[model samples]
Structures are given as C-alpha cells and as structure tokens.
Target: MSFVREDMNIVIVGHVDHGKSTIIGRLLADTNSLPEGKLEQVKERCRRNSKPFEYAFLLDALKDEQEQGITIDAARCFFKTDRRDYIIIDAPGHIEFLKNMVTGASRAEVALLVIDANEGIQENSRRHGYLLSMLGIKNVVVLINKMDLVDYSEEVFNKIVKEYTEFLNKIDVEPNQYIPVSGFFGENIVASSEKTPWYSGSSVLEVLDGFDKEKLPDDKPFRMPVQAVYKFTGDGDNRRIVAGTIETGRIKVGDEVVFYPSGKRNKINSIELFNAEIPESAGAGSAIGFTFDEQIYVKRGEVVTIAGQPKPKVGNRIKVNLFWLGRQSMVKGKEYLLKVGTAKVPVRIEEITKVIDASNLQNAVKESIDRHDVAECILIAQKPIAYDLAQDIAQTSRFVIVDNYEIAGGGIILKDLEDDSAWLRDKVILRNNKWENSNISREERAEKYGQKQALICITGQKDVGKKSIAKELERKLFNDGRIVYFLGISNVLYGVDADIKHTDNDSREEHLRRLSEVSNILVDSGAIPIVTAVELSKGDVEIIETAVDSDRIIKVWVGEEVTTDIEYDLHIPNYDSLEAAVSKVKTLLQDRGIIFKPF
Candidate 1:
C-alpha cells in the first residue's frame, strides 16, 4: 500500500505582537491552504463586529484570544506544499503563555522564530530561541517580520540578526536561515518580495519545504511503554494481551521480549489486533497488542523491549534540563508528579545546579526555579521508572512535571544518576557486622540437623520449570531426613523487600540483597535453603554470595536454552521428567556434602 508523505511538524514562536499568528494566517490565505469558507467566515465576523479584518484573525481561533487580541494557546494548522505536508504549530508569544509555547515547540522538528524588525528583538524572542535549542530543534529559520514597517531597511535586519545570532550561539543554537518578511502585507511569504532587493534567501514557503521531516527511529531498540493489560474474558475469550503503541523499532511474533523494571521475559505467542489479519511484525507507530506464551504479571508503566537489545535505564534520581511554568517557584522539598511515558511517580527537586535566564544566556545559582525559568536540576522520584537518555532516544526521554494536577513543567532527561541503593549497601554492611549471635552455636545446629547449611538457587528463563524442580528437590531432601526448605522469590517480596519496589535495576539489586540476608539466617539455623528465581544473572548470584559464604552457595540452571550469563554448578536441559531433574539436583547436593548420604 502506498503511504502518504511523512508530515513535518514545525513551530512558529516569538515575542507578543511579533506577527506569529499573522504569518500563519497570511500563509494559509496566500497558499489557498485554508478550508472552504474559513477565511470568509473569520472576515465576516470581523466586519459584523465593526472592526477591520486582519490576517491574524485567521488564527487566534479561541474567543478569549480574539477578544484579548493575543494567542493564548498553541494553534495547530495543517497545510501542504508540492514537496510534502506540514503541520504548523503557531506557538503563543505572550509571556504568560510560555508554557503553551513549550508544549508546542516540544512536538516540532523545525522552528520559525519571528522578530519584529522595527522593534529589533524582544525578551520572548530571545527566550523562545533558547527554548527551541533545549527542545532539540536544530532546523530553525529566523523571520524578521514587520519589515514593511521598518521600510525594508537591510541595516535594521542585519543588526537584529547579529545580536540574536550571538545570543543563540551561546545556547548552542545556530539558526539555519534568516529572512526578512512582512506578514501583514503578505510579502516574502509564498513568493519572493520585490520590496527587499538586498534579501537573497528563499521565501517562507520555500524555506519550509527545504526542512526535512524527522525520521522514524525504527532502527533503534524496541520500546513500548505498556499502556494497559487487557484480560477481557467476558465472552469466554481466554486471551490476555499486553497493549501499547510502539515508540521505536519493530517486534515480531516469537521474539523474546523483556519488560523493564520488572525484567519479566516471555516469548510473543501472537500479535493481537482488532478486526484485522494478524500481522507477523509491526514497526514504530503501530498501536498493537501481543499475547505471551507464558502468563506473567505485567503492569502498565513498564517498558517492553526485545531481548538482547539495549535496555533502558532504571533509577529514581535523574539529571534534567527543565523549564518551570508553575505559578509559584519550583522549590526544593515540594512534591510534584513526574510523568514519563505512561508512568507517573511522585518526585521532588533534589538539587538545582544552575538556573538559566534564556533571554540573555545569564546563569545563576538558585534554590528555586521561578516562573518561566529554565534550570538544570536533579529530580528524585518516589519509585524507579524506566527511561532512555535524550541523547540516545529522544522519544522516551521527555517528561512533564505536574503540580497540583496542572502540567507545570516539561524537560528531557540528560542522565540517570547513581542507583538509589548506595546507602542501602552501606546499611547492609553495618548490619552484617553488628548482627547478634544465638546462644546455641551454628555448629551445634548443623550437628543436630545432620546436614550442612547451603543456599541452592534454581534459575532460568520463564516457564522453565525451575520452581517445580526446586519444590521436588525440597520434598526429596525432607523425605531423606535432611533439614531443607524451598523459598520462592515472591515469598520475601512482601515481607523483606516490601519497602522498595520489585522493578528497576536498583530495586532489583536491593531485593536480591534482602533475599540474601534471609538465606543467610536460614543457613545459620543449619537448614538448606533452596531459592527459585527467574533469569538469575551473574550479578544476582554475586549479591547472594555476599551475605552467604560463596562456598556454601550452589547455582543450578534448568532450561532448554540458556539466556543468562551465569555459571552454574549443574545444567538440566529440560524438566521432561520432574523426578529425574530432582534426582540430579539431590546427587549434586550430596556430592557437594550439603546433605549426608544414608549411613
């Protein structure tokens, strides 16, 4: 099937009364891009109001904006040239609507920053330029509007260009092109203006057509923030699907996918769609669902990724460059909700490294971020969330801060700070050192139980029968008069690892650390602790080895295919026969002297 040309999203931003809306209105009227009767309806309304028709009236669609004679919201309009389609976002220019401007600019891949030639440059003009840079829009065209009012003076345009270029350069933004135009008179918009003999650049429409569309990042790693888990079994349908829109890369049936934060790995049983033929594969921009081979618990806010691909970072603390639009200054200690992808978590401003004045490129140290202030700060979320760095994958890196149920700020994550478990590790160290001893020595308990204390971990891929094997081994040891107990990872999740979450790298590490402590206590009581985990990595085993003596820990892998980088004491190809698998594990335990053979 033939697809339409990719539409380019471009934003027009500038100071109030700088002709942002006027330029868009004139572009629509001149290019015959407006809908039938739209321009006439606007002009007719102005005539009935006993006011002269102005090009700006074509936009300012909101009644409040028309009455106030300003654009208060980002007005989006669709237009097309012979080259491609364009969605022009007319961002508000008023200082009060700076937040609206940011919302519009953040969606755009290219920008047109307007400045009045007569007024030279205004505060919002400089601020908008800086914000466009922070939003990662590199294709920018600066328009020197109202040139007719300045008598098309080349000198006036040059002076504004020189000053603004220097300001933008400081913010690491080099404008793509600069053009002099008169939006009210419709000169240098659709066609070149005869009035400006000195200006040699292309007209606004030509410059717009020259801007390239943002490429779809299907080549990158797959990323889909789980929107919902649907278990619609009302009509006796037994399908449970995980649904979300793919933000990048592609996925196919039978591909092993891993859910971030949770690290649950399962194979895609089938691609699910509504009233459509099942697709073998889907790429970026497809809103689809999938049924997994194994029934694993997956929740919304977890990022779905293909196995063996680069994983997203998971941490509670993040370094970001954000613009604050809250009425009150964003201060430290105040709680806010940070929304990234489908995840919303409570967050606080941990530190403000620098508060930037976008208008003049001035930097200052401040404890709070004032209204319309852009700052580099560290934010600490209540729970870890999965995200990519803006430099790597911009689609999943941007986030919004909601204050009092209002979107008060937006920004892109720069880096994931150190995991939240640094202090926890220290606490664990102190705990091990200061741990109390029982009246009966560990040697006495081992002699009484007639078995050596050991921690045996059964781990492999999902649905690999590690749990079944571990349980069977537990029963065999008990029947053989050995002191042994089976421990599932979920058992400690509610009691010991209850304070932290189950997902994310740091929380997962902390969870394993606590599990290690529990295993240590069980072993100290001279009982064999058999733990079953899913996809235990080398690092996970090391965490357990820290608490329990490495010599007393045994790792076993049970699967047809090995997916983790863990060296195991024994590898059972599959659990085709449960008793056979259990026998192999018991033999390994007996050979290792964890359990004594019949005397």
Candidate 2:
C-alpha cells in the first residue's frame, strides 16, 4: 500500500497590514484548495456589508477579525500540491498577537515572511525575521508584497530587498530567494505576471513545491520520554506498559533500553498498540507503548534510549535562548513552570547574561526581560531533567515557560551547563548505584518521622547569630517531637579534613563534599539536619547541593543584607533576637510543607 507523505507546515508571518492573510487566501483560491461556495460566501458577506471584496476576508473568518480588519490569532488552512499536501498556517502580524504567531510558526518547517514594499520593513518585519531564525526555521522565502501599489517598479522592490536583507543578516538569517509580488492583484503568486518584466524567478507555488520535505531523524539515537506507565489490572490485563511517542530512531522487542536521570535499565518485552496486531518494532513518530521484561522504576520525566547508544545530557542547569511574551517582565528569582517534551519542572532564571531588543537587533543592559524581548540566560531547574542541545536533537531541546498557568514564553536549549559540583555528582551517582537498599523505603522513613528531610544551611557574616538561630530552630523542632539535629561547621573540620591543608581549594571542596555526604545519610535516616556555616556563597552551597537533591535543602541566611548570589529560601534581614529568628525559621518550615503543624 502507498501512503501520502507527511504534510509540510508552512507559516506566513509579517507586521500588521502586511497582507499575510490575503496571501494565504489567494494561495488557497488560486490552487483550488477552498471548498465549493466558501469563496462566494465570503464575497457575498463583503458585498452585503457594503465593503470591497478582499482575498484576506476569506481567512479573517472570525467576526471580530472581519470587523477590525486584523487577525488576532493563528489559523490553519489546508491545501495540496500534486507532489505532497500542505498545511498553511496564517499567523497574525500584529505585535499584540506575537505569541499567537510564534505558536504557529514554531512548528513550521518553512516560512514565507511577507513585507509590504509600500510600508517597507516595519517593526514586526524585523522582529518576525529574528524570530524565524530563533525558531530554527532555516528555509525562508522572502516575499515583498504590494508591488502593484508601487507601479511594479523594479527600483522600489530592489530597495526593500536590500534593507530587509541587511536586517536578516544582522540576525544571521539568509533567505532562500526574494520574490516581488502583489497578493491583492495575484501578481507572481501562482504564475508569472507581465507587470514585472524585470523579475524572472519561479512563482510562489513553484518555489513551494521545490522545497524539500522534512526528513525523519531515523539515524539519530532513539529518544522517547516516558509520559506514563500503564497497568490495567482491573481490566483483566497483566501487562505493564511504557507509553510515549518515539521522537527519534527506533526501538524493537528485546532491545536493551535505559531510562535516564534515574538511570534504570530494562529490555523491551513487546510492542503494544490498540487496534493492531502485535508489532515487533516501531520507528520515530510512532505513538505506541511497550512492556518491559524487568519491573524497573521509570518516571515521566526520564528519556528512554538504547542502553549502549548516545545518552542525553542530564542536569538541572542549562543555558537557554528565550523570547519573553509575558505581559509582566521575566525577572530573576521568580519561579516559572518549564515544560520540555513530557518533562515539567519548576525553574528559576539564575542570571540574564544578555537581552536583545528584537525590533532593531540591538543589545540592552536590562535587568529584566520584558514582553517581546529575546534573551540569553542560565536557567536552573528544581531537579535534574534529561534533554539534548537543540542542534543535536531538535525534538527534545525546545521548551515552553508557563507563567500564571499561561504559556508566557518559549525557548531553545543552546547548551547544557555543568553544575559546579559535576565531578562530585559523578561519584554520588556511582555511590547510589552500588549502595544497598533496606526493606524500609525513604518515603516510609519520612512518614514515620512526621517531617521531610532537609539540609538546612544557616549562614551569615561572623557574629550575626547564624548558629544561635539554627540551634534554636533545631531545638524547636525537637521539642515539637520532630526528627531534627544541629551541627556546627567547625565540628567536622578537624576530624573529616585532618589530612587536607587549609590553603587547598580542592581540599576545602572535598571537606564540604564529605559534610554533604554525611547530610545525605542523615536525610535518608529521616532527620532535618541543620548545619551552620559562615558566609556560605552560592558556589559553596552548590557543593552540598549536588550530593543531595537540592529540593531537600532549606537555605536560610541570617543577616541584614545578603552578601552572596545564593537565593536562600528564607532570609532573616532583621535578627533582633534569637527567639524571633527561630520563630520565623519555624514558620518558613511550616509554609514549605516540610514540618507538620504543631499541637
């Protein structure tokens, strides 16, 4: 049996009033893609409203859009060429609907950026070009519209092309070709027009057909994020299924599979799919599930890969290129929900290295990324997530940020950042793999103690009452019948670091590592271990953070002013008395759901 190839998603984007909708309407009408009476119905409405007929009216199907003469959202229209089918996405050109345009264009394989030659390159003209480049749409066809308005002048078309070409160059984007056309008049749209005698190139329809189809990444290593584990025991089914779409490569029955971040291994027992006979194998793009031979634990955020193949980078920190579309500014210290593939995690912007004004491609020294601003920054996830660099694995690297439960921004992973304690983390991973497990699990210990485990680090300048508050807080929890302990920083220096010298930075890090290792054990024993260290910077705390899950650490700084980059969970800006400080810390613990309510 023969199957039609996958449809190519093409998006048309530009500034408001640049005639993006008109071009799409014209393409659909010219190609005979529109259903019967659809065109006449739109024209009849225009006639009844005492308005001149326009091709754009066909796509501005919404009543508000027709009244306002503006598209407020992205609309998908279907068309076909003899070679293959096409899904033409009509993305709004207004700046207010920039996010809507991104939502459409982000998934497109090719882009047709329309610029009104009469208006020249507007604000969104440059902005959209920069966005297409950022969205990884490498194949672009620049169409300079409204040539008829300029009397089809070659000089006018050439001027717009030169200016727009320079702008695209600033963003490192090279267009496939520059076509001068008039969507309203249907000049050089489906066929060559005599009005443009100086121009000689393939029509828009021809160029579109010439574009190559997107090839599936079968050669890349298999990557399937475990979305869910299914067990239909009540339905009389004994199979435990791992289900998700294969993003790249293939997996077959009996193949050795590894789930990342937790690093569990198993073999694919059988390929399972509804309404089909049992298949032995499946390739990329197959939305299927499988049963594993072993009862290994794999979570939703983990990626499944062939055991011996290339594995995705696993970490909590990443350098990203993002476009902010939130009404409020994307600021540091604010927690945002980041979703990449099937993995969702709470993330914070660690640092904004640079911000670029998309309108002019100029760099700005801004403290916060405002709406419509593009930026490069480092993002720290609450926990480690498995992913790949956008260049290496496009399917797994793109992500979205949800603010206020709405998609506020989108980004691509430029590179994976190594945590400060990467070397020590390697050792921790190896240690956990070889560590013995008892019948009592970690969750059981947490529930038995009636409190969550945490490495509560209290640090500040000398004589700022850091240790006093930590000790009092520990005493409070202990009196409340909760598992708690307080240890001083100097308590382990003489014993744990007897062989290492004070001047060696590596030895100092090792000392911190040992302290964290001990904290990890105490946490496993279901104790809230509070450790007091003097002036512990973010980098210093990172050592302890890697050995234990950072989520299990409660950071509190006791000082009038913070001296380090560490964003502590709780801060005592005014340490007037020990009792007040202890009360505040205890209240914070209660708020974090780490400590149960006291009687």
Candidate 3:
C-alpha cells in the first residue's frame, strides 16, 4: 500500500565543525531511514583504520573526494516519517566553498543554522545568516549543537542564543526557535532530553516535520523565461515546442502570450508532454512545453508573460546587493557574465555604492569587492534584461556573476534605476514589435549600398566650433566617395521642433530625442548622418545611441572642456583650425573602419 507524502528541502548551514554532517547522520540513524548494515559497514571501516567511529563518518565514507567533514557540495539525505519526506541538504560551512553553499541553500525552503555550543558564533555563522535572508529563506531553526561538550548547560545555550538572536534580528531574520542538541549523543534531537529540564520546545525531528510544504503561488502574474525553443524535425517530428518552467502564475491553451525584451506576441496552441495526458493549463513550477498558434521568433532568455498581465521591467542598468566570492576582487571595468534565470549578458560593476564586510556587518572603505564581501552596487549590461525588483518578485530577481568561466558572485536586484534611454527603448521595442519587414532586408540594403549606415555625433563645450568641424568632415567624407549627411543643430531645433515650446531643460531633451529618431531612420537607409550638438552629455549620447545601433554610433569631443559624463572616443583640444580638427576626426573614423582604413 502506498500513501501520499509531501517533500520539503531543508539545508543544514553554519560554520565549520558545527556537527552538520553528524546531525544528519544521527537523524538518519535514529529515524531508521538508512538501509540495514550501512551503519555497521562504516563502523567496521573505522575499526580497521584504528580510528574512533563517528556518526559523521557514515557521511564521510560516502564523500568520494573531499576529506573535510564539512560538505563541499550540496549533499542530500532522504528520510520519511509518518507524515512527509525530508531532503536534508548538507551545505558547506567554509568561505572557500561559499558558491556551493549558496547553490544548496538557495534551493531550500527552510534552513537549519547549526552553531557550535562551545566555540560560539563564528564569522561564517553571521555571514551565512545574512546570505540566507538575502536568498529569501526566512524559516530558520537555530540548532545549538555539541551540548555534550558544553556539559548540557542552559547558561551556555542561552548566551549563544542571546548573541546570535541579536545578530539575526539586525539582519531582519527571526529564527523559529533556538534548540539545544548534541548530535554526537543524540540528546534533544529526536527526543526531549532530561539534561535540559529548563528547556521546553519541540525536538529537531518535530521541528522538521512541522515546517510547511513549499507551493507554487499561482495567484501571482505569470512569468516563464524561455529555457529553450525546441524544434525536432528529425525522426518525423515537425512540432516546434517552447519549453520552460513557469516561475509564477498559470497558462492555458488559447491564452495570448507575449515574449519580452523582444515584445513578440502569440497564442498558445497546445500544451505538449511526452507519453502523458496533455495538460490544458499549466501553473507555476510546472516544467512543460507548448506549441504556439503562430511561429514567432521565440528563443532562450526571453521572458514569457500573459499578454494582458503586468510586464517585467526592461532595462540595462540596475542596483543590486551582491556577495563576491571570487579569488580576485570584483573590480570595476572588468567584464563578467550576469546570469538571471536563463538570460546571460556581459556585465560590469558600474559603481560601488557601498561595501559591507559580512563577517562583522560593518561598512568597509573599499574601492572593489574582495572575496566574501557583501556589496551594494550598480551593474550595467550590454543589453536590456527583463526582471522584477527582488521586493516585488523573489525568483526572477536573483542573479549570479561569472568570471573566467567560474561563478564569482551572486546578487539580488534591489531596484531598477532609471536607464538614460529607458523611455526611448520602450518606444523602440514597441516599434520593432509592430514593424513591417520590407521585401529588401537590411543585409540586402548594405550589400547594395556598399556601406553600412552609422551615426557620428560631434560634441564638446558651448564655444567649441562643432559645426565647422562636422561640416568639414562630412564634406571630406563625401568627397572621398562616402555617403554622409551633416545635420545642423539649428535645423534640428527649428525643423524637427517648430511647434514645441522652448521651455525648460526638458525641451532640450525632447529636441535631442526627435533629432535621434529622425537621424536613426536616415542611418537605416544606408547613410552616415553626422550630427553636431554643443555640450552634449554622455546621457544625451546614450539616449541617441538607444535610438540607433550602439556599434554604429561614433562619439567625438571637440574641446578640452569635458563638462559632461561622456567618454568620447576621440578628443581634439585645439579647435582653432577647422581643417585640422576635421582631419583628426576623419583619422579616428578611418581607424575605426567607419570611412576607410589606411591602405
């Protein structure tokens, strides 16, 4: 006879030598979860080696490579009571394997934070507590272990509890209870021990059974990041499937679906499963596939949402709370891969807002994040990714950073900052979503024109002779058999914006937006548009670049007064002579293959 039993993943996390493995070993032994002869086999090996047998040695024997009692990888032990089955994930305690710790701990719904009763709270004890809150696992049970060594003293347990409770409260984590237990002796673990007569609380086994079952919150809005767009044409399979695990909400057949970052829209034709009855609808946590009513260009990393539901924020820059575990410090300007959900993009630390040393939870005066440092920073990526703030949606908000093919850091986005080009990007995405393709492709246009389109924006201080240099460069490029058009600043102000009032700073921004919009169309028509704006900020350049292709835009500052935040590709200090300045600008273009490389 079979009975239904739910599953709960619980992680045992804390400092090294805190008896995490021993607790797991004892739990398995006392519960009769282990197969017969398993415990005796481990004892026999220990006797042959002339070593005192330990319950932790039962787990150690199963460890194929790592010698330390601390679990290097996320090791799972299965046990079942009359109620439910538990997956006790043994997570590493050392800082060296923090990435592995996060890997195990993040997946757990509830956590067991074990601390040595004798040694007291260590650095990793606090650090792991901080990270557990960040990982969104709030149901924690503080297991004060090794009471046998501490002589089962209530004073010792209470002192550690008082200290650790204060720290946890500081980090916004209130553990369920502080339980005293001896993993080695099995005191107060499976049963209430007389050694602690002053204590009256549930046993470790009781607490384990009492934790709630993890469930998919289907009431929330639907979100499914495209894991893979499958097309199995071989072996007589013609149906293309969109495969993924729904992170939230539910989806049904015939429901309109939208894929974001691309903004493609379609309807679900059918839910697909192999050798199982087809599901009419799938809810959050369901790993299934569906065929679309229409073939949209869906691919991996695009988030799927119900067409009428709330949309995820799309941006390239965001502020995050991250912990760096890399051997090398997480320095600015170095490229790292940011992986959130299935989406991966090249990222860099745009700014270090604050760095907090996790060991002491104190602000550290640092320029770059070191190993095991928790930091609040801003990250700028090459392209926009769809996500929600961690406060709004927990699952979609977390990400990890990879350096040199290793996971060096992990973070949760606290908030989405205003990307300079957010408004323009939204317009661009909507425009692209509804854009009608011409019979002639962009490739055909480039092939026919013998040149790809580009934008060359010349900017600097107010008194800088931007127009003279821009016109001269355009004339020179035009004379050199290159297609170029120089659009004057006055023309943009008057021709593009003859109606809008010249009121306040917003008008200037609107003027630039219109200028970029018009110039972008011309660039797409196989023409290099030379635009000159005085004292244009880097933010201004970013706004224009959002309207066009970033790779196709060239920024040049013509004067020494670099007032704006722009990182210009080329700078000419002396703007006295138009011809010389124009020649210098042309040299940059030639070097960049914008015009022509020197033969």
Clashes of each: 2, 0, 0
Scored by TM-score, the top model is 3
lDDT of 1 by residue, 1-599 (tens): 99788688899999988888889988888888888898889889988999888888887653346777888888778887888888888888888888888889887888999999988888888889888887888899999999999899999999999998888888888988999999999989999999999999999999888876777779999999999988755777767799999999999999988776655677899998889999999988899999977555467888999988998987788999998888989999988999999988889999999998877778899989998789999999866678999999888999999999989998999998995443554454456435555656454576788888899999888888888888988898899888889988889998877888666565777888889889988987889999988888866776675567667899999887889878899999866699999989888988987777655
Encode model 2's per-residue lDDT on 1-599: one tens digit a residue.
99857579899999888888888888888888988888899889878989999998877763237777788778888888787788988788878788888889987989999999888889899889988988889889999999888899999999998898888888889999999999999999988899999998988988999998878778899999988988666766656788999999988899988776656677899998888988999999888998977554356777888988998888889999999999999999999999988989889999999999899978888789999999999999876788999899888988899999988999889999987556776776566545555556555677788888777999888888888788888888889998988877677777766677867866878988888888888887789899988788876777786677677888989889788878788888886688889988888888888888656
List CA RMSD, all candidates: 15.5, 6.0, 7.0
User: Per-prediction TM-score, please?
Assistant: 0.71, 0.75, 0.75
lDDT of each: 0.85, 0.85, 0.85
Assess the local accuracy of residue 421 in candidate 1 as a C-alpha lDDT between 0 and 100.
49
Q: Model 3: per-residue lDDT, tens digit, 1-599? A: 99767888999898988998888888888888887898899888878989888888877776743265456787888777878888888888878888888988878998999999999999999999999999999799999999989899999999999999889888899999899999998988888888889899989999888877877779888999999978766888657799999999999999988777767677899998767899899998888898976555456887998988888988999999999999999999898999988999889988999999887899976789999899999999867889988988888999999999999989799988887667777886786567554555454565676566789899987767888888888888888878889988778777878887866667776788889888978887778899988888766776776567667888898877788878788888885678888888788777776655667
| Backbone clashes in model 2, listed as residue pairs | none
Worst 10 residues of 3 by lDDT: 435-444
